[model samples]
Target: MAKSERDHQKVEAAKAVVYIYINHLAYHISPETAVLYFYQLMWDRLTPECLPVRDALTVVIEDEQFKEEQGLQFINRSYYSICNPWHLDNKKRPYLKQIIDRLDREPETESINRTTQALREQWMNFSKGEYGDCLRRQMHLGGHEIFREEDREFRNVLADYLPDYFYLYRSVTRTPDIEQLEQEHSHPEYSGTATKQINRLRESYDAVYEYRNLRQQGVTGIDHPSRLELAEFEKGLDFYYPGRNDSFKSKARTICHKKRRYEKYASYRPQVKEYLMESVELFPARTKSKLTESIDRALVRFDDRTSMDPITSKSLFLGLLDSVLLPVPNTSNILRLERCVGDVGPMNFTGMLLSLVLACPMIRFRLEKKLGYLYRKFEGKSLEGIQWVVDLFEHINLALVMNARKIGYFSLTEPLPDAA
Candidate 1:
């Protein structure tokens, strides 16, 4: 419960931060500069309460100012760290004295358009179910020749590797276990709305999946974008606040000031704005709060019959919306996470750094030693089997280090490169 409380607090803080970020841009920032303003959105979340986040944002913003003072501009779309426009020797150029502040400063190249483009690309890739194509090893063992009795043992693992994506989650299309679902949620009048929502979900799943299937099998789903795409994807968070490095930390309470504002990638497809609005909406935390006052009074008669407990029930009810309900499949998310992990050290490294910067409290930081520790903990499992899995994880870490270097998060001056 104690740990859960801490986690709850963290989630709340992070959510609040996200709300502020999105809302800010919705009000003041232009679509063109929205990407740059994303940094400021992150800063808004890093208040006195979130000191580490605050401090990190301050330093990062300062670095940006410092770099502009020099002659270096930040590169966009790179992960790990801010890459500068100036060369190492360019630091020696005395002529760039006026904007020397920009030298080695953090870059904000991940503009809004770039973000949408990358998201669209990822979604397309995900929709197409392109999981196995990028596997470190792509094996085809789907023949009776290789399906001997011994190979049957590997069937479960093979199935696990196979991606299972539904255009819609089982929530809408599949009938709910009425006994397990909320009473109001299962009401008759709302069934019409639920049916429509379910249809939408199903349509989304089939449209994306079938389209991708055709595309993969030599049918083009849609024409690909050009070099000058929208805002690029960025990751690796600052410690000062949970969202200091996040592009749109506070997206929930977005207030649109523009009369003709569009979705992230609307320019590419004119209909994209409608798709986004239909697809996305903030989860209902405020709705539940407002409904609470009289909802209990009205529902009391039903509750006695249903024997419902509000305290234990509300959180679970709200959790469905609160979760990161991705447009992509779990296979895609897992693959992305694997790819991301390949680029990032296990979260242990980030946690330690955040602690160093934030000075907030104690956290169990151990990425450096995580490899050995996790191995030992799971030792009783099959040695050969577990070792293989561990090896996969290690490979991912190595990849993460590589990504870090590419994005300029950490310098790979000595030990990493030329390593045998």
Candidate 2:
């Protein structure tokens, strides 16, 4: 099949999976928890550049303070019987059988360290060679993994910022066109502190996105970036700006051009420090009038803003997002699992915080390392109380996918061509 046809099929498959969970499986478990499992399965099935055995062994012996224990467990117990490949009589495990067959074809040899290196070499070669095509297809068509069957309550007092499952499921079934999907990713049901802040962020990011596009199209004078220039450029566009004043034009120029001005005055900089402050301020009011006052106490480490990159800034943003519910500011260790509880519970609050973070186009994929850190930290814990963290991870996964759609990597909304 053509690549576009294959892509269409892949997306259709994903949508079907979403439909099954929302309509059937969700009747038994929390839809939020199921999304967590969806992301876990996708990661387990898709990312095996080297030997699965090697990865499992690495996690077991990994010196990294924050290793994801569930990574190995989820793959072994769910994907296939990788632990005992020779006992592969099960037709359900074709993927496992293929891996063993590949190993069988390798030259007969054995060594303590050399054998280990050989398996690594074999997987590397296999993943980069023609077999790689099969791997991608197999990933999408892989057998179902076990799902957590019980519904769980959140540990903290989290407000319900998510749409009802019925509405969310209905929305998924009626997947909109790519254009509409991009424009209305936010749901009306979500109007928590984080949601409101994210909406503000979306406005700022939209302007930045437009400014970047205009510059790339060879719009002159914006190369140096000034509101005066952007205002003149805007006059030609279809968008209406009620106040076409100098400061409004100048503010646009600042946001698009001052990408790395994180200093003492960084708090006032557009789309950088200022955006961070606005998002952070959405935290519930506590003793100091702003709950973020505690969070910013930890920002002292980031004082040397001169060397800070977008990743660091993103880390800071998500850290504060995670800490929004904290009784005290401990941004040093975000997602403070032990202290994640509130009267309403942590699930909805964290989910809302994550939704807001994903609204900003700039930080969409810029903070993967931070996310991986949180996943590792939360892995192996009971899903009964902390399912929210898993739910949070899935939100990140959805955010990343939407980011890809925005950039046109693939499409779920492509209409089938007219039949011949």
Candidate 3:
């Protein structure tokens, strides 16, 4: 066969795979699970050879081809694509970013659009049958209901001990079996410490159950004593077990110290705002307005900075760059940074810094200056005392070093001008 024919055959096979996958997803799982899970399933199935096909499918799905043809809407489609777990691996970042960049550059010109449209139409027609109707009904009921029967049986077995079981399960220590606890507490060998611990657990369980019951009975404003009960139980543990409570006390002290530091730090936000305003001139003319606007917005949103922890505070600052500087052009690329940093918890500060450099190359020095000041204040502090600040310092240093290396490489490898 000719090379062109072979290539055509490959394309046709990919389309078949995509069409089968989409139909299976739309009919079986899409409505039952969250869109993120659907994306996860797709990512798991997409091998290197299938990546181009996946990209094509992304365009088709995001462009609302299925919705337009079948009147089926996909909620949070952009989030599912951008925050797809597959994108988290650094190795996959460049490939996914390239696809995203190309899509942004030419969204209207997907070569496979016609093929995708035909596949979608076929899916819609096939899904209009009785079998499809049954699948749709099941999807509408959702996965939760499917497992509810099993859950109910399990819950019934622990009806009286649900609160205790839940508290133990959520605790840092090993969870004791409810049945075993009943049996062991009755045993003659049960020690005083074990008895006390079990009693404390029961007290906590009662307090929580009572609180929840009152809430269910429309008793709002009733103070919940579960936390206080648990704290007392923890205190008992400290009293009974030497050195067992030291870690807890140290953690509590650190939290209290952090709270004090944050209160002091918050007082300097006005100064930080003024500093940022002055540094706006450091940004290019095109980005200066947006950068200033972003600063103002962040200040307004996080006026009560003391309410947030150090990690949260840093994330909010990075979120400003994510919103203002990153010209990701489309929802998909927007998700790239959001999934990386947004509400997902503490990201690698280095990655955050690199992304900022990529988005706003001119702001690197300004970021360095601001972050350096913050770092110096916490430099000699204990790891627990300044972990967030340390992360910020790493972000700045990595960004600067990476940017410098790039610049150095370009300067050394500058090509000679071609002879006219």
Candidate 4:
């Protein structure tokens, strides 16, 4: 064979190898994982000598055609699996830093030394960037700003309470005299003085009102505060009511309900509801009724008791719709309403509506009126064009896979072990 033909054959073989590897890895591992694995394999196996194959593989993977075909353009519903570990790791980092900073500030006593050593080991693990891949995955998923905001809040809270660790540690080791502290405030002679101080503090900070409410609702230091709650109370006392010793402040902090940490999850309902309403509005009244009927039918599959509540049914129906329309990574879309209406009983009409809006350009004009944000992100291009691009990539990827298999470059029957 001529050198040109041989080079072409080599490139074809490499493309096939990548196709087989990507599909196999995606099945056993995950799509994101598979992509990373493919990148690593190419870098490791292909040397500078095989520039043709290397360039071909890079072009095939990076090409817009390939990406759209693999559903890489829109966020994968399974992408949340990638984010969850990172979210957990991100949550732990602040606490670990707090511990490390606290230990560093303390005198090097035997107990402090032991704690410091243990914390250092934990800090090492945290520094390993275990969630680094998840952080990278978020670029494609959108809404990453929410996670970043929460992380910032976590760090800010830690920074604000750095000095209160001393009190926090004392609270854990030496239990506060809850009854004595309460009595001091309640005593007739000291009552006026304590009440004046409490009122001043309450007036100064809104958190005090929340604390007082919790106290009125029966929360007390004797009930044993969580570490976080105890920390907040100690910090408040140290900053706002310094006359009270660390122990007293610790007891005070336990007097309120713990504040929630993050509000992003809480906001999901309104956001999803807004999108569902917008999508529904694009349809006529008759179509809207059909959509509702489909949701009601799907609800029947769940427990009748739970499905009977209109609110629950509505939320579930919206959740199902959201799952189909804007499926988040790591969530279950068992209904698969996005695929075909015939598969899900009585859901055909709703399914057909979704399919038309998502796939048909003419109908998308109506959809764009409600879902302009989606279009804006894609630079006002029609979904049909995007689908076409994806289809083109799928064809190329499959052809490459077939050519590689025919050339006997890689075995589809036996996949390599997971790199992860």
Best by TM-score: 2
- lDDT by residue for model 2 over 158-258, one digit each (tens)? 11212111112112111123213324645322212122223323333344446656766888654322122344334322121212353222333444355
**Model 1 whole-model lDDT (C-alpha atoms):** 0.28
Query: Model 2 off-target regions past 4 Å?
Result: 1-97, 100-264, 267-274, 277-282, 286-291, 294-335, 341-366, 373-382, 394-420
- lDDT per residue as tens, model 3, 1-420: 998677555544544555555444433443334233343433232334346556655444444344552223221222223322222233333333332232222122223456444434433443453223222221111122222443223422212122222112111111123223334557422222223333333344345446545766888767654222344423322332212344322332333344433464466456545534543454445455655676677666555645555555455456555454333345454344233333222223333344344333344433533332332333335555433433333333322322332212122333422210
Candidate that would win on lDDT: 3
Kindly list the per-residue Cα lDDT of model 1 for residues 164-202, writing each as its tens digit.
Answer: 111111121122222123244554223322223233333
lDDT for 417 in candidate 2 is: 20
Model 3 collision count: 0
Q: Candidate 3 versus the native: TM-score? A: 0.22
- Whole-model Cα lDDT of every candidate shown, in order: 0.28, 0.35, 0.37, 0.32
Model 4 error, position 169 (Å): 48
Cα deviation in Å at residue 253, candidate 1?
42
Candidate order (TM-score): 2, 3, 4, 1
Rank all candidate structures by their lDDT, best first, as comma-separated numbers.
Answer: 3, 2, 4, 1
